[model samples]
Target: MVKMGTFFGMSLGAFVFWQSMDKVHVWIALHQDEKKEREEREMEVRRVREELMQQAQQRDSVA
Candidate 1:
């Protein structure tokens, strides 16, 4: 009877651990995707600013 109880307890603990680990994995994936998107947006902003500055410089030189 004690052995049966021990087996049940161990099985429950294993299931709980597996579920928590799955949640952690999902969270990490979401954070990584967000970081990638943020970096892309920042790069785009910098490119646009550089282009605008170049245009302004060209106009000044022409005038």
Candidate 2:
């Protein structure tokens, strides 16, 4: 009877651990995707700023 209870307890613990690990993996994936999007937006802003600076320089040279 003790052996049967031990087996049942181990099985339950293993199932709970598996579920928690699966959630952690999903959270990591979502975090990575958000990081990628943020980097892309920053790059776009830098590009636009450079273009504006170039245009202003050209206007000043003409004046």
Candidate 3:
């Protein structure tokens, strides 16, 4: 008696694995870029609001 194991064809397995990894890489990259842009926008908004508030306080103090 002999025992045999099942194996996938090599090229097909490689291609399917590569495709799945590529998709995941693309998704992660896009998500990271989106988060960075959102953070930058929020920072800019905060900076502008702070500047305006400081100016208002200075003017009120001088009055």
Q: In order, what lDDT does every prediction score?
A: 1.00, 1.00, 0.90
Expressed as tens digits, the lDDT of each residue in 1-63 for candidate 2 is 999999999999999999999999999999999999999999999999999999999999999
Top of the candidates by TM-score: 1
Worst lDDT 10-window in candidate 1: 4-13
Q: What shift in Å separates residue 25 of candidate 2 from its native position after superposition? A: 0.6
Candidate 3: the clashing residue pairs are none
lDDT (Cα, 0-100) at 46 in candidate 2: 100
Relative to the true structure, candidate 1 reaches a TM of 0.94
Report RMSD for candidate 1. 0.7
Q: In model 2, state the lDDT of residue 27.
A: 100
Clashes of each: 0, 0, 0
Candidate 3's residue-wise lDDT over 1-63, tens digit each? Answer: 122222445666888999999999999999999999999999999999999999999999999
Clashing pairs in 1: none
